[model samples]
Target: MTAQILDGKTLAQRLKGQLQTWLAEVSPQVGRPPGLAVIWVGDNPASAAYVGQKQKSCAQVGITSFGGQFPAHTSQGELAHLIQQFNQDERVDGILVQLPLPADLDSTKLLHTITPDKDVDGLHLVNLGKLLRGEPGLQSCTPAGVMRLLGHYQIPLAGKQAVVVGRSILVGKPLGLLLLASDATVTFAHSRTPDLAGLTRQADILISAVGRQGLITPQMVKPGAVVVDVGINRTPAGLVGDVDFVGVQAVASYLTPVPGGVGAMTVAQLLLNTVQSYGQRHELVMPQFSG
Candidate 1:
């Protein structure tokens, strides 16, 4: 069977429209628009592209954007100080430090400096702890986005076997927890996991978050299983995901495209998190979206 596309781009646009309407109604009462601060360092091309997309999305959703790009040589102390400033800024509802900071900088320390409430990226220890406890908190964008997309599509997860192919804190580990919370039996496989294809073929829901191109071949996928490709690999041909798209499209029941799938949802969820934080701060009731 030819797999149906998950079509995250359309869903993301719909979500943004919803946010715009909500902000229009609430901004007047709150006395100011929800504000998001993005602290970007260095000249990483990918990071620059992501930051631009985030700022553009913020404008669309009526969220004020703050913070600016810093040079590669910017020190850890300076970044920590800036995070503290945003934490104390009443106008700022969310603070995010673009990842892949200079190698010399301590990313964990800088991330921790942002207060838990304003940590929209949801990488702070406090937020992670909340996730570990299955409590309400800002969630890491990509994994949250994946769950949102699946929920929007009405994909079943309860009592199903789900395999997550990655181990990084950003996506794989947290995503495993989310799947578990939905009552799916979860398995995490990494580069060292022997017979990766065997593990993947048994999954009712297969997710590949490792950044390796063409990692999840059609042979590795179980027929009728749902596949979510979260990898973002930049090649000369353009952006691609971990799965072999053309091949897997014929084998799997559903699939998420690279550029338009998880990527679009991630930005949408970041905006959603910022709005949620804003609503909480103002004692406003935020409407819940599916998943």
Candidate 2:
């Protein structure tokens, strides 16, 4: 059977519209718009594009964008100091440090500098700990977005076999935890995992977050499994995902497209996290948006 598309772009747009409407109604009472500080460093083209999209999304949803690009030579101490400043800024409800900071800079240290309340990227140890404990906290955007997409589609998770084909803290590891919390039996596979296809074929839900293109082929997928492709690999043709889309589309029952799927959801969830932090800070009741 041909697979159904998950269509995250449409869902993301709907979420943005809801946020815009809610923010328009609440900003007057709040006296200021919720703010997001995105600290981008260097001139990485991909990072620049991502930052622009995030800023544009913030403007659409009434979240003021703060922070700007820094030079590649910008020191770790300088970045840390800036994060501290954003941490203390009352108007800024969320702080995010764009990834792949200069090799010399300590990304972990800089990330930790942002207070847990304002760590919108949810990479801080505190937030990760909260996730480990299954407590309410700002979640890593991509994983949260993946979970949101799965929930939106009403895919069964309880007691199902869910295989995550990556182990990075950002997406794979955390996403496994999310599936486990939903009562899905979760398995994690990585580069060194033996018999990768054998592992994936056993999954009811298959997710590939590893950035390698064409990692998950049709033969690796279980017929009728839901496949979520979180990879964003740029090639001469265009951006593509880990899954062999055309091949897997015929194998898996449901699938997420490369550009319009998890990537769009990531930005949407970042906004959601920021808004959630804002509501918590102001003691305002935030309305839930469901699929």
Give, for candidate 1, the lowest lDDT window spanning 10 residues.
282-291
TM of each candidate vs. truth:
0.99, 0.99
Candidate 1 Cα deviation (angstroms), residue 173: 0.5
* Model 2 per-residue lDDT at 5: 98
Write the residue-wise lDDT of candidate 2 on 121-240 in tens digits. 999999999999999999999999999999999999999999999999999999999999999999999999999999999999999999999999999999999999999999999999
Q: Per-residue error at 164 for model 1, in Å? A: 0.2
lDDT per residue, candidate 1, 1-291, as tens digits?
999999899999999999998899989988999999999999999999999999999999899999989999999888999999999999999999999998999999999999999989999999999999999999999999999999998999999999999999999999999999999999999989999999999999999999999999999999999999999999999999999999999999999998899999999999999999998999998887543
lDDT of 2: 0.95
| Runs off by more than 4 Å, candidate 2 | none
Q: Can you give the lDDT of residue 43 in candidate 2?
A: 98
